[model samples]
Target: MSSTNERMFTRRDFFKFSGAFGAAAGLAVAVSACAPADTNSSAGQASTGADASALNEDGTITAAISYELGTNGYDPMVTSAALTVAANWHTLEGLTEIDAATGETYAALASSMPTANGTTAEVQLREGAKFHDGTDVTAEDVVFSFQRVLDPANNSLYASFIPFITDVTAKDDRTVEFTLAHEVGVFADRLAVVKIVPKAAVEADPDAFSANPVGTGPYRMTENGANKTIRFERFDDYTGPRPARAAKMEWQIIPDPSTRTNALQSKTVQAIDSVPYLSIDQLKATDTVESVQGFGLLFAMFNNEAGNPFADVRNRQAFLYAIDMGKVIQTGLSDQATPATSFLHEEHPNYKRAANVYSFDQARARELFAETGLTKMRLLCTDHDWVRKCTPLIQESLVAAGIEVEFTEKKSADVYNTIDGVPGAYDVVIAPGDPSVFGTDPDLLMRWWYAADTWTDTRMHWKGTAEYEQLQTILAEGLEATDSATQEQKWGEAFDLISEAVPLYPLFHRKTPTAWDGTTLVDFKPISVTGLTFVGVGSTK
Candidate 1:
């Protein structure tokens, strides 16, 4: 297929770009967050599961997490680390919260769900709520939290999630009024994006507060991610609906899939996330393991800067068509994922099939490559274990299609560190991301990659292009439309536009596997997100 002026990855003088995984890829970085006493942290002093003797104390939970804290701290405003974000869910509260297991939004800090429609709505603070530090939760504190995230100067990554909110003002000591740009039916649900913080604590010492946040949630962070292990204690003063059932909790930051699996098998931790695909059946023998389908995905992102070979939409589309997604899903992922039919997985509530879907067509791929004069390309891939599985096969397909491949793998964090980001930074990048950990809304998911300056400007370099403008307009219409059918229609249009653009897109949606001891932990429902959640979970040991 040829189009008028179809820019191809051909000219000898032309440069190529790299692809990075979208924000919805859920794998954690290989490294853990900076810690003051990491080596000394002991998540378990318990015997192995085979010992037949119990040593863990009652009301205590231990877990091994595949995600590490990396350079980020515990602050909900900016930290994207999978482990830190999940931990925050235990130690923080918003006016409303989306449950980790059910995806249902419920009032947490607010007395009840407020009328989040219209340009204006008021929220009443939950009575007798107290912060981890014993300070009473008040309306002013809620306003402060929202303002800090909305403050452009703060550069909070979450600001993009609620662009409709114009301002937040405390109507009185216990009531706060939200001023929106327009009516938003999901307004209360989106508020969960910004976890309420204590103004006094945050202002007292911002750095200290980020490392160890104080909130009105069920748990208090005790370890601040020092020593590769994070510890939490149940906050007795918390007056929220989901009170912590465990008195103490310890999380071992184990990024290596094998080590994380062993930690659970050896009874070192009660639960673990990111169970390697091959190890799932083995783990099921000794523990309860479930692979939950979610919005997490491994994606290919292109460099859309002028002169970059992938600057042309045709090349981007051709790259997607080159891969055999059926084989990739079956062999590479152990049939653990669904090939992308839309930007979202098939399970997503707002999922709409895109205008264009890339199925493996080697003959067509070759035709596009030959049309564009593209013979050789460099690919940069993140070295996550599972990613290692898929990239090689993706490389194999391109090579079979008569393209020379210069493929390089690096730790996810290191890729961004060394990349100078010239016009074509290694032609393309394949990495993992999962922003659905924030919320599952179509607007929230699309904003994360399309409208966000970080992805569109710095990564894809498509911010000022005509296609970007079109996608943004469609997204705005969807978010502002209160009617369900109209919003879905607009969102479907946005998905179709992005589907054709393919600036950055998911290859497949992942089925995240999590394992926990059914006999030891009570009410421990596995989450489809990157890490583990222990809220309302207890231990019988």
Candidate 2:
């Protein structure tokens, strides 16, 4: 594969030329101002054999997701909200994609695997592919989409996910090439992080384009809805492996878990995500509910900035020993979650037991606290319904260890913002995360928090520490290694260093519980991460 003289857009050029979007920005306005339509549809006739109901009269599927979609609009270049990206997963695509449930790699916009030689990959696009607007997908569109994400002015949240790609170019009408800065272990798996978008439509009216996404996937937007709801209809012209099984799809942004459960029980919505832990047995007895185990884990992170008690290793270890993680998983999360023995779950191919572990020992916790002479700490937790349920248990444990804890709760986005900015205000934070949603390979999962100057270095305040430097060296060696065995060994070395330092440690990897009427749908299965997948799924009606 040879490189072409395709135009490149760097971060610096984006700042200098961003003013050109003024006309398009001004021309852009809310495409739909109407409130989100009713989240549920009326119940139809019940079905037999499987625990499901008949499909809607119009043959549409209503899905209620617990997360909000308004934070970042539908634009692939900028959106970071997990649910927003998942919704677009059906409408938009990339050269390659990692299956959400199976973590298997498959071709999407491109025809086959890219032929890689060192730092470059050659990819051929699928022939005759057309966007929802009926325009042929061209090589120019592929090149332009990569440039936008690589451009720094856009500040795409997903930009850090693909740090290896140095440049991208189109070879011809049907082929494209990617140039990586260095050979990474999971370079191909990370391509799906950025979905390809049409250059002409986006450049013409970026805001309106986001409001109404146009892609080569199986679905097309019926309305340019925002905030509360987004609706889509099948693209009759789509020529892909997973075409739309239903005529229409409606996603209602319901933030409350109870509301979503009610919507599913009433048969108003065909499926719902984030099944409440308490309602799992009830739902499973009467309907279709599953608790799929994946990389979804709640991590306990410490802010090791100067003057904070957590900066001292003794303080950090003391906090971990005080709380019974097993109890947290059992009482708050039920049996759906497993206490994490290693950062990589046991099922992962690269799984390894950590070098050190945190176990319940109230006496050891008090001793460590006494060594630090610290008796009070401010604990920050996400305001998600289930997560909030775990805080009281944590508080009780800490109080039992003779430590006073002040708890504060906020939305998931708000909690991350405080940690990302005001590092001194918080001593500890417990939040749920799943990097495997992007790719299940161990390299991608570890790189999410351990890669240099990423979350662990910047947000967690461990940049200058000795353990941080050791972890970076391990990662660099892992990335450079060509053999799988060598890569696994390097990652294990990094995990050992992390286990000893304890900047942020996993409590447990919880199973993602999802409820849907199986009798009414075919090929529908629950996912382990934040997003809900409906590809290849159809209504029984």
Candidate 3:
């Protein structure tokens, strides 16, 4: 197997499956109707002529997020990244939330579950809560905020998740009613992502609201600037038990991993998302830094609907066999990534052991290629360092297996844009797809890959089998088995059928590493799927 082909698979798997473990990862480019503004003017400048001590009476913590925040508004309904940053918002109230331990969804803002008929759900708003602007958080605001996501113009990424809801209305000052299109089991979990925003504030200036978001969360957005920084002030009116230890927080966008590491080491920044594999050992050796391994999946992707040489199952199988995943895992990832045996990570609750299925066999791969009779092929990839590093390993592996391979490197966005929206751009390309954090619902995964007819921006245009469709139906309606034992059986059957069809090739799971300054920080909890939560951070002193 050629190292080049192996690396190609790595690049694809790294991005596509990063989110499979339960948390959404990636850069979110904020999309608001308003133009960009200087959001850092008040950083060193105090508001109301107050001193830094007055603003942050106890302490302040600064965190460096790898990428700039994206198009999703501060509202959680739009994107998970926004919801992560707005974790403090729950200190105010949300419609619902997930229990961190069991992954079960529960109502937070509402008092109880919706009535059986599904016509309406009863909600009891927390009293006396106020938005940053001083507007009372009334039931009317909650209803309006939810309705905004349903608006087609908003084109919320979460639209499919809330298909059962039709309307939400305030029945009284503290209670609201949700009218449903049908009875849905995951409705509460879906609502967990809906952060309540002030109706008046959003309606008044939707664009400005993106830059200067105002919510009833425990933190308020204070400042933002282009390529500068975003600052937040802790909300003293927060009614939740986990009151923030730090009165002020700043998210400094440092795109370069090295710069972020430098910031942490120099005490200029307190914490950072995953350290690169190359830097892990060095970071671990430093007494000032604490390292946490995160749960994330990495897999290679093939555009079956794109109709290249790889569109043929035999060819894809040949490519899979021709590559050496074990060597790539050990070398390219520096032994940080684990070779995936099944679609889900071994650590996940429902994961099934299927090591034999993914085992590398160059002889078998050669036979598969001889049977397919495919020769020359092109492997499309991103110019990013990681992908670049893996591509050569894959190319070399494929060449060794009597297959000719060519490499093309383009900027990440450009590569995705060219191959995704259009068909037949290349024989194979690398990409990423994240699964929902709640759990690995086989039906949901299948729909995203085959049913939706679109992979992210790429039009998958899947030509699926009847069995796969039936499995999807079972996924949507088969949960009535009364226990997890029955549910697992049904899901296992579905995975078996899907695996036979080869809709996607499972690659090794990637681990995300976070580095922090241990001297200044006391505690940190790395949530499995959801990104790191600020709620876990505290002062050592």
For each candidate in turn, the TM-score is 0.88, 0.86, 0.77
Report the poorest 10 consecutive residues by lDDT, candidate 3.
31-40
lDDT of each: 0.76, 0.71, 0.54
Model 2, position 514: C-alpha lDDT score: 76
* Model 2, global lDDT: 0.71
Count backbone clashes in candidate 2.
0
Cα shift from native, residue 284, model 1 (Å): 1.4
- Candidate with the larger lDDT of 1 and 3: 1
Compared with the true structure, what per-residue lDDT tens digits does model 2 show for residues 389-497? 7888988999999998899977665666567756686999887766665666666667667662536655788777888777777877787788998988998887788
Tell me the deviation in Å of residue 460 in model 1.
Answer: 1.0
Q: Rank order by lDDT, top first?
A: 1, 2, 3
Candidate 3 residue-wise lDDT, 450-503, digit = tens:
444334335333455454467566665534344667667766765665555555
Please report how far candidate 1 places residue 473 from its true position, in Å.
0.8
Candidate 1 on 330-350: residue-level lDDT in tens?
888899888999998776767
Candidate 2 matches the true fold with a TM-score of 0.86
Ranking by TM-score: 1, 2, 3
RMSD (Cα, Å) of candidate 3?
11.2
